[model samples]
Target: MIQMLVTGPKPESVAGRRSIAVLVVILTGQFMTVLDGSIVNVAIAAIRSDLDTGGAALQLIVAGYVIAYAVLLIGGARLGDRFTQRRTFIAGLAAFTLASLACGLAWNEFSLIVFRFGQGVGAAALAPQVMTLIQRTFTGAARARALSIYAAIVSGGLLAGQILGGLIVDADLGGTGWRGVFLVNVPIGIALLMLAPRVLPVTVARTDRTVDGLGLATLTSTVLLLVVPLVLGRELGFPLWSWLCLGAGALGLAVFVLVERAVTRRGRDPLFAPRVLRAPGLLATAVTLLMVMGTFGGWLFVSALHMQSDLGYSALRAGVQFLPMGVTFAAAGLCWQRIPAVAHARMIPFGLVLSAASLGWLAWLSSAGAGIGAAASTAFALFGLGNGLAFSPLMTRALAAVPVTLAADASGLLTTSVQLGTVVGIASIGSVFFELMGTTASSAADAVAVAQLICAGTALVAAASAALAVRRMH
Candidate 1:
């Protein structure tokens, strides 16, 4: 099953072939990392009830992982460059597996949050290597196919988290309930860890670059300050301390940018490569990707809560409702490359617009109290198709302009933007939904309707970004 590609000068076992086995190993790491991002939401209620914790603690269980992952992504990517992609990938996967086990055994909220953060750190280490490996291992149409499949899996993982979490919680295997969600990653990770060294292609480590310690510290502070208040502020009634934290986060970001620019000017490697910033369509793609993917996180959060809390659906029923979206996403991703060049260029924008419209329709249906029936299912399917068409092409086009040398850096930046987008969407939009539900005494369905409206608006802007990117491409 393995086909030898441009095998490098490494040992025979680690070089000389690109196989499905290698692809699976890389993509599985990606799937696990992305899966952990959203799986906990489905089990949030169960986790709270079982652990006897409050809403704030539950939010931390989710947000802590994201924050850690987002802040460390660039550093993780740098590690891949400095310490060989294969080594970092294996190390990260091992750490992630151990952390997942710890999370399952956590006896209290504090322990769970700490372990979740560790899981994020592990994910950050592995994420950039997935894309880097793809860039190194494949070329031409094969590369395009690989990237498309990767995109599908990433999007699919977001939806699957709910499905998997729901199943585990409903099964209550060994009376563990929500803990099974984390535990399930253990065997899978262990299998990947064992197989990786035998199948993965090895590349030379770039030792010229070192970690940007100052840049890392400043960026971490910036992300924490911005994310922490949004997630915790409303729960604490928007205390003055939270407002101060937001202000400080803004200041930290300013400092981070200046530091990065200086680092670039001094002929030293910065956390973010200066050259990547100059690439056409890169900035636009990053913004659009963030906006588009952010909605995925926010949508799942509000929808899961509304379905379980308001519609009184069982966990299984709630998760099943998203099946339509997952199916269409895979279908559209597979077919996107078959379209004509002219039409293909329009795919991202058109998909975004279609997704926005579908989401808006779903919002209307929710407000009308149409439950998880045929109409809502159809809407989700349409939304998924559009999202599929947009994301696969968007990622391919975005990275098409990146230099091969900076592939790891670009991957890190892309993944960081994604995690940040997901966290922000969950914190801000979820906060809006929760606050509205409390103060207005609106039904959960009604709050979800309002939240979906915000998501729809973000989709519209993403469409605009896609349009701009297309123009730049031409």
Candidate 2:
């Protein structure tokens, strides 16, 4: 028999002294996850050198973590709902810390990749609980504000990771060098692990439900089959295996849908609650994120390439060039709390339009040449504002109506969509840009303009979809 999860929360308000404690714990967990994501990007070369890893192996170092992380997210969230989120969280932290130590002390690329996968496992277990806990703790107004702050900080955390990545590798920190990057997390993880059990609530799961193993297998296969080939395909010139992986990925997804349906027919809560997928509000929210995050990821990848490869900016300089946009994102996140609650969902559609406009303008400006500094300024500010307003609202709105009983599964669904979108975005756009640039007899300025145009087009589609979805919500 499928047991219904016991929806236990301390209090909805989380006001005064008690709620404050929980808030810190929840936000801390979120920051850690966001931080780890981008932190490794800037340090990839350092790791490769220290471990004597090759390009393929180093890519594995990153890809392994990401693939494992993405595959396990739904499973982790379901586990949290089946057990206590608090206990699951504490355990995840402990494992993550230990894994970080293993990563730092590793002697080879193989060990590093394995430990990184372990790290991904820990992150998967820990992440959804952040959303689940926030839902349990706050009411309407407080919840919206907290989500905005969370979104903004998560954005900043990614940017800060690049900065820290540079500083740590350069500082060499007693010649432990790249090792410091992983080692630094150990102490923080220990501290959070210790504090979390004390501050976090142990919401009970009434169900002793086991995970839908068939569903898990099918989903994992779908992601790997799709992402691995796409990431490697262009570089390998789209070999036969690439075509096979694509076909297999599609097949796996088909099977997954069938499996979910079968489990639901048996009167059990499937790997994901089918009911959650049927909610217009929830599904809209997920689709919005799917498009929004894809645009964001595309922008990040293309902009970095244009700035560094075409414009001749130093690596650090290229990163700094993005500072204006990053700062604007941070400011909006901090101030988003002051905005009226009734206006929260409205901001998403508006921001989507603004983002589309910014992308459109930036493409024109880049086409005019890098000397159009003023145009660049305008584009960055607009893009930042749009993203800041849209992302948080999209997340908050999609999550608002999800009952405590279904929180974990729903959160997992969103997380999966977000990551999958990013991977797909990079592959789809990056492939187009690289092919177009290589074959064209155009100047560097023209090539960048082409890439920007692609990004603008994607952003435009995202904006339109978001608007349509929000309209349906009303």
Candidate 3:
């Protein structure tokens, strides 16, 4: 009875025609959200030039969305539990659609930043509900398959952002340039809204009615302190204030843990359930994921810069260079769960090692003065294959130990961590790249080589952590 309850609904009842439509609608919304995250990256130069903003402003445009999404993610998950996943998801999609429209029409940097933040908030509100619905709707093998496809959407969306953004800007549709990226989401969101009500499964809301406001406050504050400083610190030259903010963030994290423990002890629901923290090897998994994603984000930013700024490739041409990675990611994602647990454990380390090796090879190529060519494309494909092989296994390994009741918490935390890692990666490695460049055009190749090496280091660390985590699991 408990197992049935945890699984939510029987496979046949929810995994039918209606459910397929529901999944399509939900994944479409997801593709839009994830697309927004990366699409803006390719458009950053256009956005900056058009808006007459500085580099710092462009960074804010990117980091602002990420910060909002990360901070609100847990709250969004809790809301879905209180309000029902279907309702929460629909509401989120509506807001996201509206936010995307606002982003499209913004006239100034300030307006764009505000709208971008709104889009992030909307994304947060919708993201957790996807995983929650999958939990409630699919069972066993079907659930694994659904999750693999969802992972593909995530990776594909990142690639799409670069590819689609390049195409839209290069095409200059309606003379909108970068605006096309945000505007594209409006129609997609509208389509999802129309389809969702007709197909989504309605599940009962959980009965844990109380929200631990203090826990939420502390957690948000902690994350803000950590993330805000990382985003701005390099631009500000790592002032004393940045160090103070980092210190405060650490203190705030400690306080958040204590506050949540107190809330749980008092028999009130905590912002984060204590049990999720206690899950075996989850901490290691989170750390590994953070490092892996951090490398991924840094690689994206660095490689794009290398292609366009260093190699003088057009945006569209550079974007096309990433197609191989995207293709391999989708293909490998489908086969993610087929590997046995023992093999999966080794796959993480093996994949990361291969990923790092590819990056290192690319770095050597750049240092040797090789431009983007057949050799670089092959290296990129190998990197993509490694990424595809690693991501799903790591995600599955982390969530596998979580109780079904705590799925929402795990989902929110995991997504938040990924976004946070992205911010950190962009800030830290990007700073390294810029510092290496030293305001000289001649240094571009050297800077890119060094940045790729740094990314390889991150991948190696992730591999070490994943290997250690698996060892601990045994």
Q: Please estimate how well model 2 matches the true structure, expressed as its whole-model Cα lDDT.
A: 0.72
Model 1 spans with C-alpha error above 4 angstroms = 1-17, 439-442
- Could you tell me the lDDT of residue 379 within candidate 1? 95
User: What are the models' TM-scores?
Assistant: 0.95, 0.87, 0.94
Report how far residue 160 has shifted in candidate 1, in Å: 2.2
Clash number for candidate 1 = 0
Residue 27 of model 1 has an lDDT of 95
| Rank list by lDDT | 1, 3, 2
Model 2 clashing-pair count = 0
> Of 2 and 3, which scores higher on lDDT?
3
lDDT per prediction?
0.86, 0.72, 0.81
**For residues 131-215, could you state the per-residue lDDT of candidate 3 as single tens digits?**
7777667766677778888889988998898899889889998899989989999888888888888778876666545456788
The TM-score leader among the candidates is 1
Clashes of each: 0, 0, 0
lDDT of 1 by residue, 162-238 (tens): 89989999999999899999999999999999999987877777767689999999999888999899989988999
**Candidate 3 stretches greater than 4 Å from native:** 1-13, 338-342, 472-474
lDDT (Cα, tens digit) per residue for candidate 2, span 273-362: 876786557776677777776776656655655564566554455555566777777777667657786886677777877877887788
Question: Predicted candidate 2: what Cα RMSD to the true structure?
Answer: 3.4
| Candidate 2 structure, TM-score to reference | 0.87
